[model samples]
Target: MSAGTPERTPTPGQPRRASVPEFGHGMVVGKFYPPHAGHHALIAAAAARCATVTVVVAPSRRESIPLDLRLDWLREVHADTPWVRFVGRYDDHPVDYADPAIWDAHCVVFREAVGPGPVDAVFSSEAYGAELAHRFDAVPVAVDPDRRTVPVSGTAVRADPAGSWRFLSPPVRAWFVRRVVVVGAESTGTTTMAAALAAHYGTSWVPEYGRELTAHKLARLRERSPGASVFDVRWDSDDFRAVVREQQAAEDAAARSSGPLLICDTDARATAVWEERYLGSASPQVRAAARRPALYLLTDDRGVPFDDDGLRDGEHLRSWMTERFRAELAGSGVPVVELTGSHTARLARAVEACDALLAAGWSLADPIATPHTN
Candidate 1:
């Protein structure tokens, strides 16, 4: 249900600092491509002075981030303010601040979403704030016109997410976090690489859910039959499905709290390879669960000693598994870096790959251009 502070009326001759609001209804409209801290502060300032505030989170259809996702993040960030309302509409109309026809076309979309009203105040920080307020026949209240308070913008964020990381809320950060997955054959140092990368970056890492599932199976078998071994554990299509679901859920949860980069031990695509090892074929469902990560670090089995961790397969299967992983990942579009040699050397190479990815920065398509006018 839509939630916000209850609508209220200004009391007659009340003190300015009292509970009474300055305006009956206030409106805040913007593209909110990603809704950074500056956007939040503007809405907060409006909510403080108005009895009720309506925020229109409008973005063009060509934008990468879905419109509903933008609205969801804005609502989550402002959930505590019950008097503030957030609505979304696709404003695909061309942006030409000086053109009256373009302004009228855009205002029509905003007005329909805000409902029939007396919008007493139009709160904004854009150059068109004065004209927008005049169209609504409301007072124009500018907040942080010079961008000194928050010191961030959607364009700046889209250009360099890591630099503007602090300006993004948790949900927005989760969407921006770069996921780096480490995958390899048994005893090929996948876990070690993932943990080391997380430590080097001081970020959160997700452990292999498939390993936890394997241990659980072994423990359960031991409970039924005394001294059960890893070999006794059974495999089924459902087991791989569980791994994919749990792995994805864990990665998503970690992304919200992780640093600029998130390290993952093994992802769904690796699980599909493991499924092929045991079942001779990868299930359709398991293959579908594979998602594209920012980068993939495949720890080559060569030169790495096989250490049976009580849950790993025999040493002979390591070479076959490594080859299978290589063949499968070849067609995957994401960048894959094969880590070989000593642990130290592989870690150094992995670090270089991660640094390069972050350095490249994000590439978001430009929004409708508002030509500069003198």
Candidate 2:
């Protein structure tokens, strides 16, 4: 099961539903190109009226967002209502409400997932609700015919996700959040830059998990050998793997709660670089853990003085580390913004890069357009 969203006030024009549980099984079908509040409201309304609801989250395989992800988001959002069951199917069949054969092809897929159970009511906010209900031999119930109540659509959201940010649930928001990662050599101010950028954007930032692991290892070493230093801390491929896993987990968690943009001190890609610095070379698994982020802010160690925190012993290797990061990042294909100069200047440059990334609106491929889309 997916994680549940925290209890919060519903978005305006999207009313919360109270489960009265009157009818038998109800059905709701949609592409849910990117499930938003309006979609949630429709599902909620269905769950309210019926003892059980089967939501057919059918989208073409050609669509950008995966069917599994939509099902996950919907399942997580309505977790409180266990009666609402979510199912997915790749309905690549051509959509044409006027065509009876096309409708039959689509209904076959829906019926396959819904099983032989009778559908008492078919709920939808589209023009084809009545026809769909007629085919299912169920009552047609329209939730919101006009766009006034929930004034957002998949087309509008795909066009401008940032503008329709409020309509998205936490899980959906996390999917759309543009992750910006900051990485560099020791004392190059990656953490400072990350936090500064998050502050500037009024969003959440992910702190480096590798550093925390380093501290933990150092502390453990000190317990056995009191005189042990940061250099005495032993590292293996598994340690870097742990760093990569933990870093990504933290980044993903932050993305769920963050605004449109999320800032991070380092990511799995940087963890691979750290692995190379410690071990001879990055392991295959470690290298594979490097998931691409939206942007990377590589802090240049050109003029920045190195401050040796208790866990860091890389002052002498700062230049080498910086160069290695640059080399690795260059081939990763992610947009890199090298921050060099005074702290103030670096922040200004970071902000400019992030702003540009946000300005370039999300590019969600248009789903196969139907005459009446839910």
Candidate 3:
């Protein structure tokens, strides 16, 4: 009789509830907008009484933070909790917070996603929380520690993140402070690829860190430094260092989240390659920063048809850039998994390589395969 064992019981006009000993497997559903302290307390309480906890992260029409970011927030808070699992709501059917039908659908989806288990209870604070419990044939435990009396909502948090964050747990707050950056040459599909990988892996990504910094620099130059002479960005400038540092910091933060893995399109190594090629020499600090990547992916210049993004500097330049990147990586003695050929082929190859590497005992913390079709 472990503390978290499941319990069972029969109910009138409802699905049979498992006996007390069968309540070990529990399911919790919430927006967890930022997974505040209150949310953590609820989850901890549930964990104490359950062998396993499944968290259902449902999308709120009232909240704007993407589902992926919210998922990241949760992972960061419960990184060490092995018994905890996460699932996002399906986009097709909107679940009505007050509808038992919706809750029934959600429970079915949850069961399918997590597989058959001895779930005997549902932990929630929604208006129909009890109904959901009945529909799922589980005991309902509602804890409204926030005093809001309404659902502990992500919408409320998004309205005033700083103010409402007090409702979130400390772990959620820490996730906000952490950042995840995706970097690569223009038109290298860094942004798209980063988004895709994040979605596939269920993590968060920091938007282009360099673009924001560059925009800020451009704005500052337009204002106080209006007449400042435009210098080639390659010249040693504090601006360049600031951008590099920002990008590096973002990547580091993303890596620390509870998500099983975080994927970055680019790393400090890519930046160093750019600086060395454009500025003639990379700063020692930048060179040192480049070594922080847990794994390096060198995309091959396999004549993948190029699109005119204006920012892309032709295939010839890309070929040269690829060569330089290889040379730099060689000098640093960092092993790189090179991906070449058509994008479709390359992606497939990458998946295979990753599967093989994972099988061989490589750390699953980083990308190890580049899928490329011949």
Alpha carbon deviation, residue 371, candidate 2 (Å) = 3.6
| 1-374: candidate 1 lDDT, tens digit per residue | 10111122111112122198999999999888777888888888888889999999878888888989998988887777878899999989998887899999999999999999789999997878889999999999998887897777887878777877777777887898889999999999999998888888777899999999999999999999978899888899999999999999999988877778989999989999999988889999999989999999999999998897799765898888889889888888989999999999999999999999888777777777654110
The per-model lDDT (C-alpha) reads 0.85, 0.86, 0.54
Give the alpha carbon lDDT tens digit for every residue of 68-105 in model 2. Answer: 99999988888888888999999989988889999999
Question: Candidate 3 lDDT (Cα, whole model)?
Answer: 0.54
Off by over 4 Å in 2: 1-20, 224-227
Among the numbered candidates, top lDDT falls to 2
> What's the ranking of the predictions by TM-score, best on top?
1, 2, 3
Work out the TM-score per prediction: 0.90, 0.90, 0.44
- Report the lDDT tens digits of candidate 3 across residue range 67-153: 677677666666666567777764334556566676566667666655675668888755566876787778998767343533334
Model 2 pairs whose backbones collide:
none
Q: Could you give the candidate ranking by lDDT, starting with the highest?
A: 2, 1, 3
Candidate 1 error regions (>4 Å):
1-18, 371-374
